[model samples]
Target chain A: MILQGADALIECLKQEGVEVVFGYPGGAVLTLYDALYNSQFPHVLTKHEQGAVHAADGYARVTGKVGVCIATSGPGATNLITGIATAYMDSVPLVAITGQVGVSLIGKDSFQEADICGITTPISKHNYLVKRAQDLPRVIKEAFYIARTGRPGPVVIDIAKDVFAATMDYEYPTEVSLRGYKPLFAGDEEVLRVCLEELRQAKKPLLFVGGGATISNMAPEIRKFVNATGIPVISSLMGLGVVPGDSSEHLGMVGMHGTYAANMATVECDLLLGVGVRFDDRVTGSVEHFAANAKILHFDIDPAEINKNVCATIKVVGDLAWSLPLFNKLVKDFAPDIKEQTASWREQTAIWKQDKPMTYKSREGVIMPQQVIAKLNELAEDAIVVTDVGQHQMWTAQFFNFRQARAFVTSGGLGTMGYGLPAAIGAQIGLPDKKVIVFCGDGGIMMNCQELATAADNGFPVKVIVMNNQVLGMVSQWQRLFYGERYSHTSLKGRTDYVKLAEAMGVTGFKAEHPGELEDILKKALATSGPVLVEVALPSDEDVMPMVPPGGCLDKMILGEC
Target chain B: MKYTLAVLVENRPGVLTHISGLISRRAFNIESIAAGHSEEVDTTRITIDVEVDDELELEQVVHQLSKLVDVIKIVNLTRVDHIERELALIKVKASKVNRSDLVDIVEIFRAKIVDVNRETMVVELTGEASKIDALCEVLVDFGIIEIVRTGKIALSRGPIAAKEM
Candidate 1:
């Protein structure tokens, strides 16, 4: 139907099955915002543009769909850069729509004009600057498609003010033709065979699957591959939940802050099969010595990432869904070459796992961080776990048995401190049916603690568990290790009572200092409907274990017992 | 190993700054850096050779180089199969007796005489990094005064170009 550009946009979003959008209004997008005022779709008004984009990111992480965020041009559009970069780095699907300066004022550097397209080119997967109102419907459809497909990432569409106001006929196309955008989603047969052959011939083979495997729904295939070969699996931080955490062969996470056995396997394995992992610097510390002697077979959906990081002897460019199955079939075909005794390998891994087991007996009076996470995992009712960066993030990663991909969302690459509360709000907005839990440390939570108001104001109910160590615990841990027992600038002193803060934000708040109180408060927090916060205070000296010293090799990990 | 690297990069905004920033961030030493337009106008080729510890580090250097947005292509042409070449001009004390011998040395190395005067001769040599070093070493006997050597610029063997994708 022929309609005003703003109304057409609203109709297009409705047609695309969008129920919620995270945004903040400004002058450039006033018409669009006004159109949304009476619309059936619910729009979340984030306090800041950064908050809006992050909320959209959280939504994307939970829903596995293209999250939509809107903002006006100039300062509003520029403010989305950090959020866009974060989403881009983590491969979160986001469609960001910005109201540009009027088409007539474009290139004149109008008061509200900023070339968001040019600015975000490097960070975004793809972006468009719509000069005409007629292009709005197709552009949004394309933006959503590009953002959600392939290696999911942020895509921006900047519509000029005039474009948002002019009359246009809206017809959302069923498909988009992007000349510069085509993602590879099927594996090459010959390469798959070579990888399989290599995997079969190796004495010890390990599969390192990342978030891509989960995004592409290749978990079943990964399980199949593991079952067929009995190969052990390790995951990157973002790659958690790709494999069932409770699996016997799961070697846990691998990287700077990963499990000892996982890092050891990466270093010493004869053949390392990487699926959907980018080999980030945190994952491959001292890249020169990383897998120095191993033959690597890397399979990824993105062509640009093929040789961008780790060297691959056999590179497969395809989606995980297609590549994993092809690999499974190829391994079956090459069963004759398969001969490797990994019993000894498994024994060594088991020995290390037993030597430095992750455990903590709750003290009679003090509520430990480990106990909180363990209890949360137990009573989560299979909730989505979102974490803020710090010691709490590490503890959550270590303790939670995440069974599904996208079940756990954390700042994997950037490790942004204030990511939790806003992200949880977004997650709740996206998955209204599921319980979204924000696990954050005191220091990290305070970074974006202001977002509690946004959550309560929007009525997006999320269970927030603040691990109150009362210091920048991760940094303090580092200082304790590297410095001369000096603690500086890590402690949060005289901060407002968090329970009072929650109350001020109109959400129920609870505090627990003992293990008994911890379980009871968590159960109560889980039972409450709206936004909630449960503070569990642990000792100041608590530390995350199985830690490798800075610049130290994988096998040189400081075992807790040792 | 002290290796020379030549990077053929896309001539675009912020390319050099991006490369330099990465070098600074990674703490990889840049012994020498020279950037200029190549045979193609829109393509800027940078020749940088860093003295580092191991071959694995060299691979990592190349990988990091590839991550830069403006860096269209990166080739570790030093250790791998490639044509390595460097231009060096040496102004040595060409005496009455050893003048002809210096000329012979220059001729032997296929060095060109770009400039010559009564008491000074500027010999320009283009060859592999080792070959240039050897030429410089040979000139030291004749009392080397001034030396300017371009860091090694290299291209892979035969018809293969560095894959930009």
Candidate 2:
């Protein structure tokens, strides 16, 4: 059938089962927007292009679908850069569509004409600039395919203004054939056998999981493997929710601010099985000292990640979905005495957990950030929680007891600020029945505070909790500890009444300053029907504990105030 | 250590920029790069020479380059038996008293005089990078005025294509 390029784009999106798109219209995208005017497809107009992309990111992270966003050229495309990078770093599937000036004006530096494909090349998994209308359908198909395939990341497609009005014979390809792009799904039998042999021989075996477990939807398989092998599991920040936080086999998150038991287990384990983890710097404090005694076995889908940071004793390059179940079967069939082999190691880790439980000082007037997170966790036990980067992010990771995969979403790799509010909006929109909450710091909340309007306009009942500390908590802590308290530009001055700001955006707001009034205010805000913001004033000097100093060994952690 | 890598990539706009941007972003300096169309219809082969201090640096560069979607395959030619060639054009200061001397040096190197003038003569030579460097050193006696050279381009001395690797 003959169709305009804009119509073909809409048809292709519908074919891909895309129900919603987050975007903001501009001059360059006028033709596309006009096509979307009376269409049944839902297009959410976010306040900013950044919010749109982040919203799409949140949607993708939760739904396991390719989140879609659109914006005009130039600044509109540039604004999506950080959000795209955030998705890229975290391996979220996203497709960003941008409108360009006419083909003739592209290199002329015409108004609103930016080389978006060039600008986003380094960040996106792949990008395209469609010069002919006939290529639009194929480009769209390729973009979605690339975005959602193995080791998923964002892909950008820029369309010229003239192409939107041009006509084409629409045909969306069902399969893509790229010589350079093939993902390995099955593990080598020899490699798996070698890994299983190592597992049987080792006494102190530890299972380390990361975001790939969740991305590949292998949480159930991992849980089964841990149960069958009786191996203790430690997770990276992005690996939370794969194994229930309360499970006996699960050690808390392992990293710079990880739990005492988790860090110690990493240092002392003799055989470490890393599934879907990159061994990022934060998780491995000092690569030389990280699991020095362990014979590491790594299973990951991306071959590039293999031996990039830490060398693997037995490397299996394949999808976790295939590898985890196979490993579980192998262990079940063999290694009958695996439970007996690791009994003493488990007993030792239990002692560590008991001796060094996470704690903080309790005071009368000042509300502790940890306590607030704990209270929120109690109230919203099954809610989808998103966080911005800061001390608050760490506190949430420390306190939130996630029970399901994809329950906790944050900017893990990029650690972008201003991620919480928009991401929460996306989650709430995508999963309307599930409760959504944003835990953001004072510094992060102010970065994209305008997203409150997006929530109110959509009538999304997302709860926003601001841990107002009046300072950049993480940087200030670093300065105080490393730079002799020479705090430069860390302290934030002036104040904006968050409750009034929430009210101004047509949402309910509540404030709690004292520990005594915190619970009541939180309950009230959580019970509100529409979007609500709860600003809890916290002590500015609070710090995230159990921090491994940068480049220091995992064994040398600063437990708390000296 | 100096390493030469032959990389096969999809022929598309902005791919070169992507490759160069990644190299610069990782702080890996490219000593020389030569790229052109390949036998395949929609593929281009780029030969890059990079200097690294250790094996880890080389491994990292390979890993990062492989992550790029456009990059199809990469092969390190340094470890294999490969034939390498570089082309050079040298314009030496020539006069009646020394023009014969320059001709003798050019004949010894089996080079052709592409252009000649009253004061300068342009000699074109193709050989291994080392040979080109050697000839340039000898021609300096005639007061070499200008020189242009292509970066090293290498091919494995076998039927196996770098892409097959």
Candidate 3:
């Protein structure tokens, strides 16, 4: 059957089970917007291209689906660069469709033309520049496949504007047969058995989980393994919520601002079982000293990750879906009771956890950021918490009690600022029944503040909490500690009012200047029907404690005030 | 240490960009790269030589390259019995008087003078990059003009293609 190119693209999206897309339309994508007018799937019109891409990324993280977004060529497509790089770093499954100039004018620097495919090449898993209308279905199919497969990432499909109006015999491909793009599901069982043997022989073992475990949804498997073996678990920042933080055996985050027990145990353990984690620099400070005494057993779906940063003594190079279940079976069949053998080690770690738990002092009538998060943890035990990068982000990671998988979403690998507002909106859209709360600092919130308009326009029930410290909290702390207290440009005091800003964007706004007012404002905000912003005043001199001091040993942390 | 990797990739537009882009993005030090269509109908063979400090780094480069969707296979030719060669075209400044001497030097190195003018001559050599370097080293006294080389390409000594392996 004959179809318009735009209709064919819409049909392709439907076949891929895409329920919605976020985008800002322009001249290049005029035909696509017209066709989308009649499609069953909804299209969200964001205030900016960056907001749209971030929304798509947040949607993907929570729903475990390939989030789709669209933009026009030139500046419109360029605006999506930061969001694309963010998705790439975090390995989010996304498909960004950018409308391009007509094929005849492609390289002539035509109006609204840009080489988006080339620009996104390094960041994207794969990208395509479709010059002909006939190639849409196949490329779209392959794009979605690549984005959602093993070690999922973003893929870009830049289509020519003329192709959208061109007629074609449209049909979506049922199967993708790329010779090079096969997702690994199973791996050598023999090596997995070797890993199990290593686990059995160790006196002290630690399970280090990362984003991969969460991305693969290995919560049940991890839970069973830890439960059966009584192994203490530590998590990377991105791995938060894969296992409930309340689990007695699970330590808090283990990195620069790692929990005392997790960092110390990493150095003293006889064996370290790394599940679905890359030894990122932020997690492995001073790689020479990281796990120096441990025989590492690395399990991941991507072979490239093994020995990429820290060498492993044994590796099970396969998806956790494959290796975790197999390892659990081996544990059930042949594992010995290790709880008695490592009782002393576990006791030491528990002592470390209890003795130096994350804490901050409260001043008279002043609200501390950690208290705000702790209150939320108690009030909204199951809320999906999102955050931008800063002191507020670390406070969220440290204080929040995540009981569910996909419950905490943030820009982990990229450490992107201005990610909270739009991402919270997308999370709310993906899970309408669940409460979505976002935290950002005064410095980061204004970077993409325009997204508040989108949230209000759609009537999305996302709670945005601004930790209104008068200065850039994290950088100022670094300056105070390391850079001779030259605050420089960090001060954000006496700036525009967040409440008025939120109200101007057509959303309800609230502010809590004192500690007593926080609980009331939080309750009112979360109970409200649509999007609401609450700015909680915080002392500017606060710091994320136990910072490992960049490039220093993880165990040699600078314990400030805490 | 320098390692040679023979990679088989899908014969599609932007596959080379994907391969080279990855190498540069990861900050892998690439010694040289050469690519062309292979025996297969829809495959391109790319040979990359990379310098790394350890075996682990080499493994990382290979694993990362294999992750590219267009890259079907990668074989570390440094580990196997392989035939390696490179083609180079060298230009040398010569007068009519010492042109015969230049010819004699080219003959000894198994190079041929592919082009000649009144002032300079172009020498064509197809052998290991080391062999071409030797020829150039010998001809330095003759005032060599310029040289261009297609970095090393290699293949195993059996019937199996790299992709099949």
Candidate 4:
């Protein structure tokens, strides 16, 4: 059928099985908006472009699908920059579509014209500027394909305004033949054989999983491998949901604020199997000291990442989907009694966990941030918990026991604030039956507080819990610890009531001021249903403990209040 | 060690930007880079010169560049039997008295005078970078005014193309 470019884009979106697009209408995208209206496709008009993109990111994380968002040219496209970068850092699959100025006006600085393709080139896996109607189908197809392939990331597609009015014989392409874009899915068997041999011989073997494993849906494989090898598993912050929280073998997240067991195990282990991990500076406190004794085995889809940060003795450079299952299969087939080899090592790590468990002493009449998250964790079982970046983000990662894959979604790579509310709304939208809860700091929630209106309007039942500490908790903690207790400009003491703010935004509001009130109020908030906000008051001085000073080794952590 | 990489890529509008942008983004310094259409249809080959600290870092540069969606293939010409050349056009401050001497120096280097004017003459030399540098060193006596150089271009000495390699 012959159709305009915008209509053809709609057809392509349908063919890609896109359920919805989160975006706002603007001048440059008017023709596309008209096409959307004609098609009556499912669309979300977010409060802001940032909100829409983040919502798309959240939806993608929850649904394990390519999240699509749209915006017009210039500022609308620019606003999506932070969200795109956030998704890129986290390796989330997303496709952002933006309408551009007409073809002739492209370089002339016409109204709403911006070099979005160039702006997003670094952040996106790939980007394109489509000037012809005929290119719509292929571009859309390729964008989605690239976004969700090996080592998934965001892709941008900018459409010229004039092309939307141009007509074409629209047929969605069934296959993409990009010569440079094939995703590698296999690793060298010889390398795997050597890695397995090392694992079999090592007395102290540690399995460190990261976001890559989760992205590849390697949770089951990780579980089977850990069970077979008896290698105690540690995780990066992004690897939270990849291992079930209740497992005895799974040590908690390892990083600057990692648990004592995970950190010590990392230091003491002789064979470190870093599966689908980047060995980020945050994870490896000091690169030279990180796994100093261990021969690192790296597994990832991107070959560039193998030696980018950490050197690997055994490089299984392929998709975790292929390599991990193979690892599990080999261990099951050949090393069925591999757990016997690491039994004593596992016991030693368990003693480390016992030495310094992640714990805090409660103060009289005070609502600690940890208490709020713990209460939420207790009450809101089977809910997707999302968090904005801050003390609350770390607290969520540290305290909340995430059992579901892709359940604990946050801006790990970019540490993006203002991510929670919209992402929670997006998750709720994607999985309507699943409960969605968002944890935000007072500073973070205010960054995108306008989204409360978006939530209330859409009536997405995402429980928003703002851990309202009167100051920027993490910043003040850093200043107090590292600097000479000079708080600087971290205080957010301005008079703004979150409960009133929630009510004003047309959502039900609740507040829990004291420790005794937290669990009951949390229960009520969870039951209130339609986009409720529960502001839990917290003291400002409480710091995320067990922090490794910047560039300090994992062993040199500032444990507890000291 | 410095390496010359012949990167074959799809002749797309922003493919060059993708390659060069990525190199810059990764903080990898490119000594010199030149791009042109290759023998293959709709394919462009880029000759890039880069120096790295070790073999691992060199591998990283190659693997990172290869990650770009428009890059079809990358061949390390320095690793294989390759013919490398750099073309430089040097416009020397020429005088009637020194013109014969400058011509003598040019002849010794087997360089050609591509352009000439009353006061200046442009000498074109195609050779290895060291050879071009040597010629410039000799012509320095005539007071070299300005010079333009095509960074470097290379081809492996084999029947197989870079894409095949």
Per-candidate interface DockQ score: 0.06, 0.62, 0.86, 0.83
Better of 2 and 4 by DockQ: 4
Best by DockQ: 3
Residue B41, model 4: Cα distance from true site in angstroms? 2.8
Q: Whose DockQ is higher: candidate 2's or candidate 3's?
A: 3
TM-scores across all candidates? 0.78, 0.97, 0.99, 0.99
State the weakest 10-residue window (summed lDDT) of model 3 chain A: A333-342
| Structural RMSD, model 2 | 1.6
Candidate No. with top lDDT: 3
Candidate 4 regions with alpha-carbon error over 4 angstroms: A333-336
lDDT of candidate 3 at residue A291, scale 0 to 100: 93
Model 4, A1-562: lDDT tens digits are 9999999999999999999999988988999999999999999989999999999999999888999999999999999999999999999999999999999999998988889988988888999999999999999999999999988999999999989999999888889999998999987977888887898889898999999988999898888787777778899988987888768888888989888889989999999999888999999989999999999999999999998888998899999988887777777865555687678998998888877888887899999888888877888768999999989999898889988789988999999999988898889899999899999999999989999999999898889999999899888999999899999999998889899999999989999998887888888888886989999888988989779887899888888842
Interface RMSD of each: 6.7, 1.7, 0.6, 0.7
- State candidate 4's TM-score: 0.99
Model 3 CA lDDT for position A107: 93
